[model samples]
Target: MAGPNSDPIVSATTAAQLPPGAVVLHVEAGDRQSAEAAFAAGHVEGAVLLVRDEVVTRPMRPGDGRHPLPSAEDLADALGRLGVGWDAPVVAYDRQHGDNAAHVVHLLRLLGQDARLLDGGLAAFTDPVATGPGTTPTAVAREPRPWPADMLPDIDAVAAHAAAGGVLIDARAAERFRGETEPLDPIAGHIPGAVNAFYGDNLTPDGTFRDPEELRARFAALGAGPDAVVYCGSGVTACHDLLAIERAGLGRARLYVGSWSQWCRDASRPRATGPA
Candidate 1:
């Protein structure tokens, strides 16, 4: 069910839904301690743990923001150490629906690999559970490749897109987008001309993604078409909206990797508060 052009999301009520020999990754936010604890309790057979902060992002700095993208060579090497080769079909999932997994899958896709998010995440996986730091396959060799130009846009591109009347989506909580509160970053408010489309809204009450037609209608109402540019506070959760857009049949949307973290740090950039 997975190939070069398959859907970016998949559901596995049973393990059969996953492509044969697909490399399953259990993604965790921040650190590996909690992930390791969870995995020790129970996890799908052969699924390896990947801490988001450690594997996909670099240390926070003034220009790069809280979670900057890792170098292409570093990412390839990390995946190769996890036994993921160039052509492996990767299925990434996390405990928090699919937000974390979506980020990993998004990066993998940018590197020209076939990657997908496991819809419904660990809660919906019906496969047999394995405990005690499940055995990982032998490490494979992966050649490093640059991220595609069109998929990863810098702050300048996002600004130009907004000025051109393109759909610029802010995938953060409404409160954060409205400048009512600032928990993580130094700034409070979203980029001017960007519409709020919180990533969590993409999931159903059961934590699975909504139907494709439903998602299509939801995003269409927000003025997001195939050319939408999506971002979040730190450029992590925005992938949830991106995957939803692709699941909605709107094609892949570009990611603003630096996102609001980069945009808000500059005193020159204008910030807008309240609803769009």
Candidate 2:
């Protein structure tokens, strides 16, 4: 899982033994008690419990997006406690929401860390793993996180990037992306030239990620490669695409944390109506 040509990040059969020197971060959104209990009982062989509020994401700010976009510094500290760094193989998960892992995946990559989510997440781990006691994976590298971002990008930056050949990947449902109905952001339309690749499309029927070759084709069509960028409403589920690209062995991608909320906030930015 260290090289550029590794297989899928998460699979059905393997709960993903954290290799010998890899860091497996098992983060669950909402409520900390359950995570602690699961950890105490047993985890994916070698896993660390990461609470959504405590260590995964920072509190949301008033002008910020609906979902909190955690600061790189805050996540760096979280990584430190979990014995993680730039090259560590991280697998974030959330039992309640099928897409919660996307948030953490985006945050980790924003800090330039090599992180991915368990495809089936908690269900996969429980199915292939048993609770009792597990051993910690060996430590491989400890390189510190990359230079942190001063702040998550707002609408202006997103518009600029969108104009600069970046792929505005919409992680919302098909209806929302097509301006059918939007229960979250103020505006009901999508960013101009944005592609509708619902976050759910990245997953398989069993909740695990789809085949890497399949993801590779979709991303290649969108032109989102190592240098490309992605966005969504409030920048939460957009990470789902980021993780998908990473899992597909395509390349690393960037996140636009503000996403549609910030874009709609500014009337000056362009908006699209029809589906793509």
What would the per-residue lDDT of candidate 1 be over residues 33-68, giving only the tens digit for each residue?
Answer: 877888778777788888888889988877876789
- For candidate 2, the per-residue lDDT at 101 reads 67
Please report the TM-score between candidate 2 and the true structure.
0.76
CA RMSD of all predictions: 1.7, 4.2
Please give the clash total of every predicted structure, in order: 0, 0
Judged by TM-score, which candidate is best?
1
Question: What is candidate 2's lDDT per residue for 66-138, written digit by digit as tens?
Answer: 6654455665665676677665666666663347666776566555556656667767764455465345534
Runs with alpha carbons beyond 4 Å of true place in candidate 2: 1-8, 12-17, 31-46, 83-88, 96-98, 109-114, 126-154, 164-166
Instruction: Report the poorest 10 consecutive residues by lDDT, candidate 1.
Output: 1-10
Runs in model 1 lying further than 4 Å from the true structure: 1-5
